[model samples]
Target: MDKILLNGMAFYGYHGLFEEEKKLGQRFSVDAELKFSLKKPGKSDDMNDSIDYGDAYELVKEVMEGKPVNLLEALAETISERLFQSYSILEACRIRITKPDPPIPGHYRSVAAEIFRERNE
Candidate 1:
């Protein structure tokens, strides 16, 4: 039930339904909540017992910055899938992808898609 939070990780990506969005690209903010038992890490005091969040960040970066997905939902899905794959100790994850300047005309801070997934095994 313990948690490790990676917040406000920013990236530039071309992910949207509009051609202009794909062409111009946009800023994305990702917040990932990785859940698992932290007891081992806490007791061992070793990096190996805990998830290396630096690695997790790179994985999210690859998905967010690599593909030109048209929906934030898909983006979050891919991230969740990869997180489950990359970290064996990860039990569940909450992924939130936010677009700071989406093409939609509105007065708002930003729009985001959030998803929660748990390990299936």
Candidate 2:
């Protein structure tokens, strides 16, 4: 399968396990790999035959910055669902979300979650 990759998308979101995290929000970085056939677009070079990633980025931003979810897992799941719902041509998707500073008192760069989903054939 071919891919359209959206990487290092940053957002400030109120998604976490703690009330403080939810109220104050934090910096979240996201990466998405959309799996689909590029055959038509590759052949015809038509916008109609391909998924516009700029639109995809906006979709991600909406989900990430919208409602507050308890976990990154849920956030990823929501994004995957929304992607498939909005774009019929999306065959599958992989989403990775990273929290730059989690609740735990650890000296780490970030905590993250990844999820992959495929359209039912």
- For each candidate in turn, the TM-score is 0.97, 0.95
Which stretches of model 2 miss by more than 4 angstroms? none
- What ranges in model 1 sit over 4 Å off? none
Model 2's alpha-carbon lDDT is 0.93
Residue range with the least summed lDDT across 10 consecutive positions in model 1: 100-109
lDDT of 1 by residue, 2-115 (tens): 999999999999999999999999999999999999999999999999999899999999998997999999999999999998899999999999998668878878999999
Q: How much does candidate 1 score in TM-score?
A: 0.97
- Count steric clashes of candidate 2: 0
What is the lDDT of every predicted structure here? 0.94, 0.93
- True lDDT of residue 16, candidate 1: 97
Error of 1 at 120 (Å): 1.9
Which residue pairs in model 2 clash with each other?
Answer: none
